[model samples]
Target: MSTLTKSNHIGRKISRIRELKDMKQEALAQALGLSQQSISNIENSETIDDERLIDIAKVLGVSVEALKNFSEDSVINYFNNFYDESAKGQILNNSCSNLTFNPLDKLIEAYEENKKLYERLVQAEKDKVEFLEKILKDK
Candidate 1:
């Protein structure tokens, strides 16, 4: 891919990530203080400003680098190739449906990690609010 195409691919990656998280464009727009149409435009753009990318990543609960480099196919391929169940006699039918890499455990683990991270973010926000309130009361 050319540099321009590669840059545009980042927008697609962001769109995919948002979809995977079950987040609507309207919700993302609300978080970014933008309109849904604006979010659509951003997803169709070739590039985004670094600061804006950071803001979007924060709203998505992911790192900016993750947004930049995320690939759904890579994750699927990794799981598909990581385990060979047939070789271990786990696949008796030898059917495509019986082919199992068993990525559900990893997905669950990632979900738990994200939940903890979200809780930490919420606590940090609460702490910031309390600090600000304490300062106002002191004044």
Candidate 2:
């Protein structure tokens, strides 16, 4: 397949999976550390990089290969299961008819928290390495 066609195929699959999960583009963008426009571009088959594809796969809890090669029927089937499970989880979590928070909202909050934690951890590791280097230099 041509590169554009391949990218379009992947984009369509990503879009389908995101919709299946009842996730907004903004939420996916946050999970992927990308802008909403970037997600839009990918969905519209504009341009996307391999790193972005990997990130999308990671956020969607799917394999990169699966995201890249998912057939339409398979995607639809997966979406049905995904929606059913999410609905069940929601019902279990909230006994009342009213929901205090939307699932996507909670997901975005969790993703943002995780992203911040990761950044902090990375900074701490870098600082530790720098400190070790300085101590060695002093010795």
For this target, which candidate reaches the highest TM-score against the unseen true structure?
1
> Against the hidden reference, what TM-scores do the models get?
0.52, 0.50
lDDT of model 2, residue 56:
86
Question: On residues 7-38, what C-alpha lDDT tens digit does candidate 2 reach at each position?
Answer: 44667788888887689999998777779998
Worst 10 residues of 1 by lDDT: 91-100
lDDT of each: 0.81, 0.80
* Model 1 lDDT, residue 108, Cα: 87
Query: Which TM-score value belongs to model 2?
Result: 0.50
RMSD of each: 10.3, 10.3
